[model samples]
Target: MRLLFSADGSSGDLIPMVLMAREFKQAGYDVCVCGSTEFEGMAVDFDVPYEAYPHSYSDIYLDNQKTGYIHNIRENIRHRERLFKGEFELLSKIAPDYDVLFNFLGEILVPSFAEAFNMANVKLFTFPVIPSERYGPPMGLPFVTENKWVNRLEWAAAVFSAKYLFSYNKTIDRMRGELGLAPSRNLLAENAQCDHMMIGLYEELVPPCPSWSSIDYSYIGPCIPSQPAELSDSLEQFLSQGSAPVYIGFGSMRHQNSDMLTRTLVEAARSAGVRTVLAQAGSTIGAEVEGSDDVYVLREYPIPHHKLFPRCLAAVHHGSWITTHLAARAGVPQLVLPQASDQYMWGEIIYKKELGPKWVDMNNLSQRKLRTALERLVAREAFTRHASEFAERVAGIDGAKNAVESFERVKSKLRR
Candidate 1:
């Protein structure tokens, strides 16, 4: 089968989808990954065919950062407005060439394209978000109470409000109209056109929502690929320098005050007396740490969290799903600084699991606070033991293979 996989959103969104594309290829399917031009190279690295779509993920990231993280209703609405303008006409143009479409957060636009081609499409999402009573409210919203009834009400309100709040009904209808289709009956039913929707995260991190079990969804775990080669000889030597360092990185989340954040991170590690290895995704952290022996800032092409996390005592990051799972699989505790989206959910998971530090808002982060968190994270023996146990469980699950099996089932049903 010819499989077309596409993704858009932040830069971190593309990495796991590329890994999944590789899995599809290995399963003897012809795979082509489409996304912002920035991910073309990633597709090539995975030996999958590449298809270019309009927009640059880095450019989108920088543009989104200008407005800051979605902290309020207005910010969330503004964010969706920006996304509505993203040109997905490319999907329409290429839709007929593929047998099946797999998209990551591409549902908002895919409905029109799927209707245009009458194709089988699946939505693959990484976030542990579903408007179910069993799972509480969606990720970004605060969990107000432990009462299941109250939590269920929050989910209902959030989902109900999203239909109007997104304010994209007319815009999407227009897109569908242009494709010679009727208007979408309910634009808020975001994944309505998808033949299936799978949450591509570890079940441990996000257990299945009990009420949604009979629906078309599955937790196939994080489809993490095999670890790439070690980054560099210098990095290896730096790891050998002292006690295991803290691995810090905020993948692709723009840091407007990168210099200060960089300095703060360095100082935090210094105060905690822990060495640091930082992946300055797009931050000025690497520049700030120049010539510092205690901190080695990696500004390389592709991050190898898989290879590096095992060498670290703890991982500190923006609570990106891939990063957190990588650290978890390595049996390393984390200090999660949540900025946006499902990051807060992962942070809560880490804290609840007793395997890492509590969530700290980036806006409120300080050298002293971070130092104290780091000290507490490392000093707690239960954290390491719990993390190690979790790691053992995670190591046994092959989510990529499981996803392929699920995809095959989808294909078989389509054949029927």
Candidate 2:
């Protein structure tokens, strides 16, 4: 059977989808990945057939970097027009050949397309919370600040943004029009005409939620595969020289004041008397820091955190879900420096679990805060013990294998 997988955004988003595609290919099933043109090289590297989706939401968001919310809303409004046209073109191109279309957290488009074309589609979520939960109160929408009145106003604006600016609502209406069905309140319900809906977070991360109808949502755990990048001889030697250094890496997102952050991290490591491997990912911070023999900085590599975490005493990270899971699985205590989004929530969980110290908001981060957190994490042995136990539990779950099996099961049922 041929499977088409659609995903977008950074390497984090693309990697999980690639993991699933690679497994399907190894299992002797035909697999094609549909995603941003930017990631076509990744698909080629895995020897999977590559198809570029016509447009991407991240492209729009990245292009408009103005500070204010209204500017963002205006940019999204423009993005909606471009996205709808692009989706129509892409769906028309890929619909004829594929048996099933799998989307990794990009449920908004592919599910609607599945309904329109009478093709099977599956939604894969990499993070703990799904998008449906994210947009509302249960997920705690980010723009909803402290005040109730402001939160309500923000919600109202968000609803308007969804209807008029976001592409999801527009795409749903277009799909409905094509299907000759009246517009529906529930997009997931409307799109349940597809074969299966698979959510890729583990049960440990996200418990089961109420299903809408015949739609299937399963928490298959974290679909983590070993993606190892070659480390330089110098780097390897450095790691060997230090007592297992704490790993610090924030994928993609750049800080405005990376120099300050880097200096702070170095001071913290020095203060805590611990060595560190700082991943200078997309940030301005260079590998070389002044007066820091205990710190090593490098670019982001595909090295499995599982492998690194065992050697490391602890981790300092930007709180991306995949990183969070990997750190937890490796049983490495975490110091989450959340920049935005659900990162704060994940940080809260880490602290609550006593696996690490409280989150340091990136905006308000300082050397003193960083040093204190690291000092506490290293001083307390309980944190390390809990992390080790949690890692063992996560190691037992074969999420990628399970996802492939689940797909086959759903495909068989669809045939009948």
Q: Pick the candidate with the highest lDDT.
A: 1
Tell me model 2's lDDT, rounded to 2 decimals.
0.67
Q: How high is each candidate's TM-score?
A: 0.91, 0.82
What TM-score would you give candidate 2 relative to the actual structure? 0.82
lDDT of 2 at 98: 74
- CA shift at 112, candidate 1, in angstroms? 3.4
Residue-level lDDT of model 2, residues 92-144, one tens digit each, is 67765777778755345556666556667777766432323322221222232
Which residue runs does candidate 2 get wrong by more than 4 Å? 54-59, 62-87, 128-161, 164-168, 171-194, 210-215, 227-230, 287-292
Write one digit per residue (lDDT tens) for candidate 1, span 1-416: 78888776555677667878888888898888877776687777778887776767666444445213444334545555445456455776787888777876534666567657777777776753445554554435433233568767766665566556556666777777888888766453455336787778777777766666556776677777575476688898888877888888987776667788888888888899888888877655667568467888898857778888888898889888888888888998888987666667778888988888777777578898999998988888989999999999878676677788888777776521
Which residue pairs show collisions in model 2? 202-221, 331-387
RMSD of 2: 4.3
